[model samples]
Target: MNSPWYIGDPSPSKDESLVYAHGTIMVISWMLLASTGILFARYGRHLRISGRRKLLGDTIWFQLHRFILCMVTVATLLGFFLILIKEKGQWVSVAKDGGHIFAHSVLGAIIVCCALLQAWLALFRCNTDSSFRQIFNWLHRSMGYLAFFLSIPTIFLIVTESKVLPMQQDGLIAILSLWSAWIVIVVILFEIVEYRDRLNSKMGIYRVAQNELMDQTTSLRRKMDHNDGANIRSLNEVKLFLFLLHIIVAISLTIPLVVIIWRQN
Candidate 1:
């Protein structure tokens, strides 16, 4: 007599190793997908900062974004492929150990379709001035965000499921901890970028306040020199200050991600 699903064995028909491999691929693949959200959010900031400098053209950023999206597309497709063929015809039986596994599968399918649509948008992308460009950008961002949000729970369900627990040798608790930590890191990074942009905009007000405070100071012994050289030196000092601040911010923002990646090594 055949054994009952989820009770008898996690991998009755297929090799358990392949299932583990699939899980690993899924984790790495989702990382790529998550990056799309970060890049999309950062696109406007990059453009604003480099609008005049033109460190690189917008097209290059577009291409880079498309490249990552393509990788995500392929990875997601491969995931679906594994879902069907990697199970060795035991797809139905595999669901017996479900605790949102089916929900994860359904969300994965939806995300894949969303990814393909975004890819199609890129292929026929409109000019920046065109009316359709805004629509395309909005839809692209919406889909990307939706996919990212749904992916969290989906990943959690798949990674922490009882059947999949044995696959992660590092222990399920650690894996989930890393996932939660990564999400928090992503949010912190986004907030840092947004904060930087807002601060730059308000620097004018800050400068006025500083000048007022300097005017009120009675302890100044000498008259201030506003010569070209002094101005240049002051500008350079401000630039140096901002640059160091950014370096600190960048390091702080990336530490968690660095730790996670290093842990993987």
Candidate 2:
């Protein structure tokens, strides 16, 4: 008896199953990566909370982060292998064109390389001196930019190839791709703005009324030991807003991963 859910012969069904599995893996890989990125970026600033504290104060959190990194790396490798296997017999000369195939290959390589670099930095670059740290920072910044640049092509390939090759269109795939792309763009823009602000501050040109007020308060504090409650409250508010933003974005990206699995079952 033929399975009602079977859409074709065994070979085609097997191929379809492989593609579906790869798609699912890709979704998982991206979600894990996004989560790791958010967590690292948010708490990374506090890695050195106290001057006397050594290497990231929270050992448990660091371990969890490392575990997530390992999981993401394994999932990514599996996803890449699946794609290669699925494309093996279907390979054509036209794949070398400057369209979906070319872009996918280039961007996919960049993503893998960036992921490796990130892992290397996290695992090995922790105890470096200032000079080494500066070099690592530059490498990290460059890799991040490259990853964001590659995400554009990655997204293009996913949408274009999926639309053309798949007989059954999955709205969820489209939504997930768009959502992932949107999150990447938002993160890139945020980093750009942050770097620009840092540059302006270093150049002594970025000054606002609030900054001037803070400076005055600092000077006054030197002479009179008094707590500037208003400034402290304002700073706390800014911190709260940033925290909420991080949580919201993290949860939003996580939703699609859950939806995809739910639909699959």
Candidate 3:
């Protein structure tokens, strides 16, 4: 086998076309992965959202999630291959200002591995009353979140590395970067708000229980249940908002790439 140092391009900054293709493909991949991951985690997992009016169900959402995961896997592979072919002998570039390519490559590999692991675990997931269901769900969900988070930095680095100015003579990479950053920030803030509300809901229930009179146990139970229901309602509402956010992000991310791809041809 060849040395580890000889696998990627040593001078990626010099290749404008390679940078354009790399940035474009990776950005498109991120858009799909982010949208799918958000949908599965926030909306698909909930009975309130997925089970309403039979609009979606566990199996339906699960299948859709898996299908999009497969797409993410394919997109990741394409991006990885593009980097390897274009950035020859640059893996682990040791200079102070270099080697980010190697970092990007390694990160992409990790996300791909996480996605595959999640998919494999999904195969064994079952509906029967088995003890493994909880473990399987936990593992699947954790990996999904991890992979999506990992992709965030990879997308950021790969896009920003390409200095192509939007509407400039060279390329439109800069605008794509802004769109990506905006979408990521919004989604992240939304998730933060969602989780904070969840924590408050749990804390509210705990406090209510703690402050209840020993003789008023039934009343306390009623209060707890009401709070829990309200919490669920708020979570579903957030999920609905997230779903809309996903649509906007997806459209914003895709339209530019599609237009550029068409223009490139």
Candidate 4:
């Protein structure tokens, strides 16, 4: 038998075009597009863009979030098919590396299916005030989170185990680590923003409730509303800043990864 390192069963002649296409598409879809869409969905509502522009009566943020995620779904499907075509519709086996390819295939399949299902669920979601809206929201969030987290592992596997790429694993790992750290930091920042918003809303509610119990003048109520509106506008400006920063950071990290993939032999 040949030396262990010389075994070539798994490293067949690969089509570079298909390989590059698959890698680039998947990287853009998950790292850039999906991240942007999720950010808009989570924090865009806090932003009051100029003139409060609306599309079909939905806020600009909601429209952007929906549109980007829909593109994510389409891109994911295209990437899935490209990889399958590259592999001749057969499961990639990496038993020599502790079944990494098999695991990646399984996890990737789950992520793709969840992504598609997410779009479908969005289409069928009940109206905001419907009694069953909560159920749809729960399921949609659960599936989206599941698919996103699962993709992390699958992405690592592609670099660490897949023999197709000639890129350095350590370099890829370092990049991914930094990218993930940025994501965590961004999430924490948004959490703080959201908490502050909740606190402000609670305080406003308390003031309203207390006023309702006492004799309050119309002018006094109008003044309170004006103050509240000013506060919200300021907070929204902050959220808009964060959102733009997030997009910049995401694009900065994603570009290097895509370049690395494209540069691979």
TM-score of every candidate relative to the true structure: 0.62, 0.57, 0.59, 0.87
Instruction: Decide which is better by lDDT, 1 or 4.
Output: 4
* Candidate 3 local lDDT, 102-123, one digit each (tens): 5766787788788678667766
Tell me the deviation in Å of residue 197 in model 1.
Answer: 2.4
**lDDT digits (tens) for residues 1-265 of candidate 2:** 1321122333433435565666566655565464555445533342322222234444433555566666766776687777667666343234243256555666776777787777777677745556688888777667655664565457447445533333323654566565666666656655554564455444433334446556556565543323333333433344345544655654565566445433442
By TM-score, the best candidate is 4
In terms of lDDT, model 2 sits at: 0.53
The digit string of per-residue lDDT tens for model 4 on 1-265 reads 1212112234455336676777788888888888888888777775678748577788888899899989989999998998788666766555543466678778989989999899889888899999999999889888888887787788887777535454666777887888788889999988898888898899899988989898999899899899888888878888888888888887887888888877775
lDDT of every predicted structure (CA atoms)? 0.54, 0.53, 0.61, 0.78
Give the residue spans of candidate 1 off by over 4 A. Answer: 1-14, 40-60, 88-99, 167-170, 202-265
Off by over 4 Å in 3: 1-22, 47-60, 85-92, 95-97, 126-128, 162-241, 257-265
Tens digits of per-residue lDDT for model 1, 51-134:
232335544445445666778777777766775675455544333646456666677778778878877887898988998888
Q: What TM value does model 2 have? A: 0.57
Top candidate on lDDT is 4
What range of 10 consecutive residues in model 1 has the weakest lDDT sum?
Answer: 1-10
The number of clashing residue pairs in model 2 is 0
What stretches of model 2 exceed 4 Å from their correct place? 1-12, 35-56, 59-70, 87-98, 126-130, 162-265
Clash pairs detected, candidate 2 = none
Q: Is candidate 1 or 2 superior in lDDT? A: 1
